[model samples]
Target chain A: MTGRMIQRIAPDALAQLSAGRSTVLVSGTNGKSTTTAMIVAALGGAVATNTTGANMPGGVIEAYSRSRARVAVMEVDELYVPAIGASTLPEIFVALNLSRDQMDRMHEVGSVARRWSGYLDGSEVHVIANATDPNIVAAVGTRSATWVDPGWAWRQDSVVCPRCTEVLMWESARWSCVCGLRQPVADYTVEGDVVHTLHGGSLRLELSLPGAVNLGNAAFAIAVAQRRGVDSDLAARRISAIDDVEGRYGTIQVGGRTARTLLAKNPAGWASLLPMLADDDVLIVSINADEVDGLDTSWLWDVPFEELAGRTVGAHGVHRSDVALRLEVAGALPVVDADIHRLAGRLPQGPCVIAATYGSFETLRGRR
Target chain B: MTNRLTIAHVFPALLGTYGDAGNVSVLRYRAEVRGIRVSIVDVLPGDPVPATADLYVIGGGEDAQEMRATELLRADSGLSMAVHRGAPVLAVCAGMQILGEWFTDGSDSRVAGLGLLDLRTDRRSVRAVGDVIADTTGVLDLPTLIGFENHRGATSLGADARPLARVLHGIGNGAAEPVEGALQGSVIGTYLHGPVLALNPALADYLLTQVVGDLAPMDDVRAEEFRANRFQRARA
Candidate 1:
């Protein structure tokens, strides 16, 4: 739906909102935006979302201001934590790992955990949480939760072990806890790098979006939808038909070239998109401190740029100068940063992609 | 004229905000700009705490992270010896809480800390997010560090380690000054949201001197220019 349609039709349309028409609330430190968009498509038509992607109260207010659908599948940031909980906390809540995110704005993972725990405490709600996380599964799960669904994605990414607060063992299959309590979680499995629910059948979390994390998100979306009483067969069917999540693994066609569009906020999100690009594809990036974008941009590291190999990349943003320079320092090949217009045009000459964090997506959405 | 030193760190994975990395990063960056190396050690706990590392940093995580970090640190006699030998460590948020004799878990369970420092941590109520600044001997121009407090626990000062700053924003030692942070040896812990090193450069420089001493060389003319330019732009 266009931004204009959302503003004008979203509110009045809610009166017609139905229960089977599921609205999934994707909450966590990372991967919420891309996952929400992908899962929305997985749920098929009759769904609307807020792409302003603020994750705060004002941002959601800005989103709901425009969206119209049977289900209001929305994203929530930690700053808007209390408000979202107080207002539009959907019937189904899919909480990704409560790891540390923007420390400048959101507190560490515990901050989110503590907040979510109390909010969810004693509520007879369906919670799709990552079971492998010691915090979510062990500590929180030990509490009285309605239903527990484990995550299969992000089993291999470099993350903190819940116990040691150190990097968990990045095993070939999945990560291991350093504290001896780390179990070899085999049932919590991933195929084609996607997390699969026990009942969601064996179709790789093939939600047109690329990345194991997306697959985990797909699983969570499917799980949440199921909890909201969507039929298992229909939810499964709808998820399989999914084919996009917008700028987050969305695409653009400029002239004869195809540029895969990705929005990377932190090094983790950056790593998720890097693997999908061919070594020879051209790349564009944007970063900034706009609004609640969490002004601390030091997280650009931790993204193993070496994994990108020798691909040539170009970038732009309000912090274009900083983004450009950091890429240079990290040994990335630089391209021209002549405004988003120039970069958009030059980007599609080769197999290319555009990545940005902050409202930089406006340039992409407006261009389309 | 001596060059100001500053160290900028990308820390979220390290300390997991249990909210201490802010103080660590803020203090280091603020100090280094005045001229200190401020070696940024992305030390994953239990991996080898680098020998004689000038400053140690950690953040909070799920009770699991705290349990694991404390256990891992306890297992390492060598690292604890290093900290005991007078290494200037700056921990914030969760970092400071884990330094003392013990930390209570989510179940109101208690676990032993490194004992290299003295302090105690206990899980508290849920709603702790608000402006926090502590009144203390160490004066900073910035008002109470503006950040949210989303932790479910609270720390109590022990006999040895002292409360670094009075509770400024939220509850510190049940309403004391320079509250959410701690100070023992060179260690300073607080719930200051990374303390945001780029904005508070003075504290950053102070942290750098702890590790690299006062004479370390840095060649980032652009970073200096960038900091000055950003600060200037904000003012203008």
Candidate 2:
């Protein structure tokens, strides 16, 4: 509501409000909020950020309007990057991995990549991008970029080379196309828990957040911190202090069982979060068709739900039946319930991991 | 008949943007549930599309991958011969477009298709995206076909192929008459991808019947509940 009012009252509010601060814009299909939080925490000073996950122009204006911090780290939405970049004139523009996300609204992944490529082509905005992702490589095409290997696993949307339009050959961690479009050599690479930097220094990222994706996000954070004149050791220390980004990965008590909330809004997100689940963790997945969650539930099939075959599963949300049906196909019989609050009684006596879409995750987090 | 069926998931890595792969899973599940042995062959870009497969499934992709897939399929000629031998093929969105005579790219330039289906696709001024319901009363003998349509191509069918379903709600083919999909003998093309078959089990049964002849019905109560909820929600 405040976002709409800010846009109406001051159309160029973000530009005026962010005049003095050194700003950093983080935008991607997944891990935007978490990465923004990581960067802010690693930077350590009084940094202005959209901690509530408000990433659009209006939200950004509100964040800037509320804080007097000299350093600002904003989570910019993929669609709003071009406008936000122009307004803030950020020193460091971080482009994380891009893949299929909100297709009904975002259209296609390639279109977004093309827009980023056009915007950042010759601009002097120091781009720190994921070298492992083909779309990120294509987006920052030939530009002088401080590339980091964040390790992308979802290759469905990146099968065709964006440069030469040939089918890309991905052999292990390296990928190349016949027409010369390939993965960029990363300046910073994350091997296991350590981030190997270009300068002969390795920082061990002992993050409190679960999943290998967070480890990659920490590597990006450390690289951004290093560019901002912060030591890698200092940045890693601050980043390790963060346990949860806005209620994600936070545990809440529910009907005598502990439930950990993990937010996975797209296929790529689910791919990263699904592997972090223990084999015997009692699971509850919630889905919604609200505007934020993308009305089409077809992307559920793209997620490999078969991995949870032997686990005790429960489906909850407005679209619980859709989640239930997907689980059924994958040989995991799910107990369906529309309300998540009522689902706690049906869960077993293990650490219940609740994987939810955007709307459902917010609702679940609020109840805690 | 044979007790075994080989299903070809064509260009899975390329044309699998949406959850269109669920169609292949549905086909395999339905066939196996009926005591039929099923083997799936994932035909990537460089691999040969098997002509001897009993059924084939193709999915939606980006414009570049769609065009590339069409060229590879045309060169291989495996899908064409399989369709000629009366093998049931299900193609979604971009997959449907590539089987036609031609379709436009992102820049609105005409690119040649495999000529498997007698139709052509041009770019639409506005992309049709939302919940779409179709009336397939006579075509597939199903009640109120429900699926989500997300595409920018306006397809015009030639004389050889016929409309698969009449759009009751959202834009389907974006044609003069509200049609959802195109169908030629044994080959089906549609923009609906609630993986299409998962939401419409009867349609999956129809495709399975084409290859394995008449089959007995299995219990699909859970699937029916899913359809019921989505159909209600779409109507609401």
Candidate 3:
């Protein structure tokens, strides 16, 4: 019910949305929240967004109420994308990448892919999309949406081909065919793993998240910043300065102690991030199935956890026992385990790494 | 003594983004666990395409990239040779799109492919975004709920090739009904991004086996460890 009301109210901003109101809508699965947040963070104005990560219909309405910023930065739900309606066509549209996210809530990616099918058909608004995603690749040139980050890179395991079970190929994770698809891949990057995109001359960014996906997110943000008339170099510099979104691979310090914290909500996200964990550090890992983190944890069977190393380690969360059992099955190096609340004081005196899924962080954040 | 595996990644050039580098980290982690070392050789647009590699990987890209990379591969005259020699090649998303006979962008402009896979691709979509699930099929496991279903075109497999998976979500061949996955030779294709190693160890095992098969003991032990770490961290 609330979802319908918000859709009705979204057009309320149309009066304020000047033909002059150039805006950005960065959408996708994992990176949508962080990438949208990064755009909102660096590009100051009455930037509106759903930073709480409520990408559904109500969240979009909530984002609008939270800020009257001339430039709106918001994350769009993959399933609810159609709910955005016509009033919210952003002046600048950005997509980090198209991947399967929550299953219980939405149809297959192709459901939304069908909606954006016109994306290949063409776009009047300045558009930004990851060059690597096939759905987006298929759309380019037709709608004339500009492709960004055309380079040689590849995702592991990969998005399967619908016809054959084979994985797609890559040159660099970046590639763009002139099939009439045109967009410049972001080149100027800020230090510290942040990307500064200069699309239409505006600038925006301040993300420290790891993963080539985040880098693409930052790059897309830079492109939006440029589209909004932000300075390119400045935007690039701003992006490289930070390190994370709250739990989507963020780092945190707890108990007046130095510990980097991060969140991995699913198998794909975890797969991309797990390789980066420091082997030498004492680590505390957590998991939870709160709706925000996707209620099912069975995908846990899909992750590659043996990489934790031979150091001291512990686990906790709503599914703590299950996690422990998996660890035990792996014959992991044994150590004393504690729940999130009991972790800080019990942690070894060293640079500690606290990692968790969605609900686990609330408990850890209080300890922080 | 450490066993180091040299990896060669063939990235199709001129696509939209290069976020696919995540695969290297996944490969490196698996190798590191068994006390193995990984050295990477990132082969990009301008670089020389190698004829043989221990493991071959390709990522997603835009339509423009498909044509550019495909043209470059055709010009190289050696990539097909490498795949023919059974170089366990892996392609994801748009990379897979380009490997087939042709892919027409949304504009209906068709670009030719290297034709390694007996399939044809076109830029058109019946769906997009969110939980694209597919059950494995054919030479591969016929049913696996892998993530990622964001593509505008539909892929149609040829007589000789088998599908990578059956579509549990998202459209597979531009047809309204969900089909299976894309495949050719040792290569498997999909749009389900994220370092696949993190979630589906089976996929990781397949890739590792093709490369360091006997050298790596990636039974349930590796899968267990990977899951334990992520699950542990997810716990608050």
Candidate 4:
């Protein structure tokens, strides 16, 4: 709202607000909010950030105007990266991994990469990119970038060469296309929990955030902090302090049962987070087709719900049946309910996990 | 009836967007439950497309991958031969477009298809995207077809091709004809990709019956309930 008022007064308000500040902007299909939060934790003091995950141009402008600090770390939506980059002209542009995310709005994965490549090409901003993802490598195209190996768990979107359109050859962890587009040598390679830095030093990232995905996000945050001259060990320590970003990985008590909430907006996210939910005796998943959640729920089929076969699963949301159907086919019986709170009452009184899409997650978070 | 069913999932790397690969999973699950031995072959770009598979499933993908898949499938000619041999084939979205005579690419360039189906696809003024409910064309014993449609082309059927269903809700085929998909011989193509067959079990059974002649009814109560719920929601 502040962003709109400022923009109403001056059209180039984002540009004007970011004029003399040292800003580091981050954008990607996943991990934008968590990464920005980690970066903020690493660069502790008077640092301004949109920690709430409102990553659009308006939200960015609002963050910049509200902060009285000289350094700002903002997470920009993948679609808004070009617009924000043009306005902020940040010292470093962190290009995280791109995957199939909100296809109804973002359109194609390749299209997003093209836009990123167009913005970063020839621009003077120092680029910190993901080396493992073929799409990111193609987008960073010939630009001198600090490549980080955060790992690419989702390979369905990156099967074809972004440049040649030929099938890319994936031999274990390495990928190469016939057009000579290959995974670049990473300046920072993550092996297990330790990130091997470009300077030949290894730093162990012990994040409070669960899942291997968070470790990957921490590597990018550490890279951004190091670029800003923060000590590697100090950055890792600060990053470990962040337990959750927004409602992600947060917990809520429901009907005397503690339900850990997790957010997975797309297939790649579900693929990474589902395994973490495997140990839970009971699980609740909510999906909504609201504008924010991408109205089409067909992507439900892309998720490997088969992994949760024996667990007692509850489905909630506007598209609860759709999710239940997908689970049924995967050999899991899912109980459907539109109201997540009401549905949680029916489940056994014990600890459970709730994984939800954007709109549903927001609704779930609001109930608290 | 063949004791073993080999299903070829063609170009999964290139064309398995939108969870369309779930179609293959559905086929495997439905087949295995019937006590029939089933094997799934994931045919990638450079791999030889098997012409003798009992069933074949192709999926939706982005324009670039769709274009590349079309080229690779065209050169392989295995899919066309399988269709010739009366093997059941299911194609969805871009896969449906790739089986047609011609379709537009991402840049709206007209590209030649495999010509497996007598249809041509051009641009829709607005891309058809949402939940779709259609009535089956009586070729298969099925209930109301319920799934999701997200496509950019308006497909027109030719003399030899017939529509698999008539659209009751969403904009399907993106054509004035109000049809959803095209069918010819043993091949079925549609824009519906709730992995269409998984949502519509009757359609899966129909396809299974085509290859195995008769199918034993499996427990599909949850699937039917899901379909009913979505159908009611789509109608609402």
Query: lDDT: which candidate is best?
Result: 2
| Model 3 lDDT per residue over B1-236, tens place | 33767777775323323334455556666677677777777776656778766677776654445555677676775567778888777777677777788777646878778787777775554445434456675555622544434556677778867777666555555544466456677877766653344445567657776766655555455445445544344332
Residue lDDT tens for model 4, B123-167: 887877788988885756478898988788899999999999898
- Candidate 4 yields a Cα-based lDDT of 0.86
Instruction: Give one digit per residue, the lDDT tens place, for model 2 in B1-236.
Output: 56788999999888888899999888888888899999999998989999899999999988888878988988998999999998999999999999999998878899988888999999999999988899886787676788988999999999998889988888998867789889899899999989899999988988888888898889887788889888887889
Better of 2 and 3 by lDDT: 2
Best by TM-score: 2
Model 4: colliding residue pairs: none
* TM-score for each model: 0.64, 0.98, 0.54, 0.95
Report the candidate with higher lDDT, 3 versus 4. 4
Q: Can you tell me which runs of candidate 2 are displaced by over 4 Å?
A: none
lDDT per residue (tens digit) for residues A32-65 in model 4: 8998999899887898899778799888889988
lDDT of 1 by residue, B42-132 (tens): 5654466665655555554445555666676676664566567765555555555667777777678788877655667766666354334
DockQ of 1: 0.16
Write one digit per residue (lDDT tens) for candidate 3, span A1-368: 34446558665643333234455666765667777876875575566676777676567666665666666776777655544534566677776555444433343444456666554244466667765666554434344455565222234323333222223443544433333332235443433354433333333334455555566666666667666767667666666665656554545555566677776665556666666665566677687656666644444544556665455566667656446544543445434345443565576667677777766776666632
Model 3 scores a TM of: 0.54
Give each model's whole-structure lDDT.
0.55, 0.88, 0.58, 0.86
User: Looking at the true structure's interface, with contacts defined as alpha carbon pairs within 8 Å between chains A and B, what fraction does model 2 recover?
Assistant: 0.83
Model 2 quality (TM-score): 0.98
- With a 3 Å backbone cut-off (N, CA, C), the pairs that clash in candidate 2 are none
Give the CAPRI rating of model 4: medium
Task: Give lDDT tens digits, candidate 2, residues A10-87.
Answer: 888888899988999999999999999999999997999999888988889889888999999999889988888988
Can you list each candidate's DockQ? 0.16, 0.85, 0.05, 0.66
Scored against the true structure, residue A209 in model 1 reaches a CA lDDT of 54
RMSD of 4: 2.1
